[model samples]
Target: MQDLIAHAPVLFPLLLALGASAGFLAGLLGIGGGIVLVPGLYFLFKTLGYAEASLMHLAVGTSLAIIIPTGISSARAHYRKGAVRMDIVKMVGPGILLGVAAGTVIADHLSGAALTIVFAGALLLFAAMMQIPPKVRDEGHAMTPVKGSAGGFVIGGLSSLMGIGGATLNVPFMTLNGVPIHQAVGSSSALGPVIALPGTIGFILIGLGVPGLPPFSLGYINLLAVCVIAPLSVVAAPYGAALAHSVSVKTLRRVFSAFIIIVAVKMIWEASHG
Candidate 1:
């Protein structure tokens, strides 16, 4: 623990940067910072000399911990904009909880490289989704309950494994299914804690009694990272939400596509090299 504390100076600055970056992106894209934070933490952990095999899992779990607050902050910001659908949140929330639990089990068994590859693939898929043509013919209706349930499971599973809040997937999916993009992004913001709560519990149970884990660890979740990042993330998230309101939708879509592409390329490079 002393050794970990000794490293605090190094980690704290990085966490602060991560929080700011996430906040800006969350505001800009209506997506949580998980996509940014998880992969970035993977490399940070690897550099810190933790076991390569556990690094990505730790990153994912810790990202979830940090995202808990950011998501809530962003969600509230969107709620104030009248973008959230209570009906959708009510219907999807339980399915997400169940799926997150299942995904945590899968994460526990997967290899680090396998997880990275999967993450890389997910990023690529997000990039593709962002680039695709819009499919919405109407902008005021929600999908059927069955579609919502299925989407919830997918979002929950991916979020649990990748440490994402599913905003990347959710926003695009909702837009395609006829929800307005603003509302989609807003509602998607709330998913972070929904995914995090069950996933964090699962990681704790799985990581208990493990040997050679990093200091300040809680199962796969890292307290050092979470504590360092969460507060700033909360503060910055509303700023990002406000920014979301300022951008034109076309400009926002272009920015979102470009951002995912850049991130996807970075992930592919890291996965290939690491």
Candidate 2:
């Protein structure tokens, strides 16, 4: 704790910068910023010399912690614009809650390297899907609000394990199921908090009394990171949401997909080398 406190000046600023960028992306992409936050936290923790065994867990937990406020902020912005689909939220909420519980248990058992590999692989898959044309992607039956239970469970579970807000999966699912792309993005913003809150709590509970956590940590969640990141992310999220409403995002999606792929490859390399 002393060491972290002593380095607060340096770390806090970095976290704030990371939060700013994450918030913008979350709002813009409806991604809840977890995809960025997890990798950023991992790098920060690694620099601080946290044990490799627990580094990924801490990163994921902390990412989810920060996502709570950011998600709410982004969601509210979208809701104000009448972009969120409440019917979809209602249909998926219960299953997501259950899946989050299951995912936490799964995360608790996995090694950090294993978790990183899984996260990386999932990112790659999502990125690939993002590259597909919408017409080709939506060849199956049209999406109905009530038909999302199974997908919600799977997304929620995988999101919990990856310490994400479930946007990566949720957005694609919605879009492929006949939801308008913009509406899908908005709805995904709302889902972020749903996945994150339970996921954050689960990580905390799962890591309780576990060893090798860094300073200011509550179980696997890093309080310091959350404190530094959440406020900034919340403040910036609205701006991103505004941008999402104002801008054409087709180009942005492709760019973001490329970025995700790069991040995934980097994670895979790190996992393989480590």
Candidate 3:
């Protein structure tokens, strides 16, 4: 607690900045912002001299916690626009729940270093994914219970491990499988909570009683970071969505791709050298 207070001069501003940037980027790119939040908080906490063993855990857990409110709002907005596919959400929901439960258990067993590698790998994957231009296609295969469950499991499990809301994976999966892009994006948004809710709880439960956690943390979820980032990100997302109408998403995506690759490499380098 004292350490956080002492560094408040430097850390608060950075947290605020991260929150705003995560929100803005989310709106602009149609992402969930876990890509921004996880790395951003990890480095920020690292600078504050928290325990190395828990830094990534803290980052991931708190990032999941922050997604809850923002994701709900996003889902609601999309639902109102008739963009959401509630049927898809149901088809995948059960598997996503099961997958998240397993993912949490897996995360709890891994060391922080391992978790960091996993997260960086996700960043690299998503960065590469974004670099590719969208391909036009006719209606694809039909969604089945088996396919939905399997895809949902993958999305939920990976998302839990990485503290993401799963849009990066979900949208692509949906689109590739013949869902329209708009409906896919909307369904992805709706599933954000499906991924986040249990994931957050899992982190919290697994983190309880762990030593060297930052102050104001509830298990792995840092309450301080969540409190600071959630509102700002929520407030900033609308503006970002608004800006999306005017900006060139292609250019923005290319720049973002470059940025994430850099973040991923830096993380890998730091892990190797640390």
Find the candidate with the highest lDDT and give its number: 3
Q: What RMSD does model 2 have?
A: 2.8
Which residue pairs clash within candidate 3? none
Q: What Cα-based lDDT does every candidate model obtain?
A: 0.77, 0.84, 0.89
| lDDT per residue as tens, model 3, 1-274 | 7877798899889989999999999999877789999999999989888899899989999999999998998999999999998888888888899999988999999989888999999899999899775442455575677889998998889999899999988888887777788998899899999899899999999999998888899999999889999999999998998999998988999999999999999988887677
Q: What is the TM-score of each candidate against the true structure?
A: 0.86, 0.88, 0.97
Count of clashes, each model: 1, 0, 0
The whole-model C-alpha lDDT of candidate 2 against the native structure comes to 0.84
Whole-model lDDT for model 1 versus the true structure? 0.77
**Lowest lDDT block of 10, candidate 1:** 133-142
For model 1, how many clashes? 1
CA lDDT, candidate 1, residue 136: 53
Model 1 misplacement above 4 A: 133-135, 139-142, 238-274
What is the Å distance of residue 252 in model 3 from its true position? 1.4
2 against 3, candidate with superior TM-score? 3
User: Candidate 1, residues 194-228: lDDT per residue as tens digits?
Assistant: 88777888887887876667898989888878887
User: Which candidate has the highest TM-score of all?
Assistant: 3
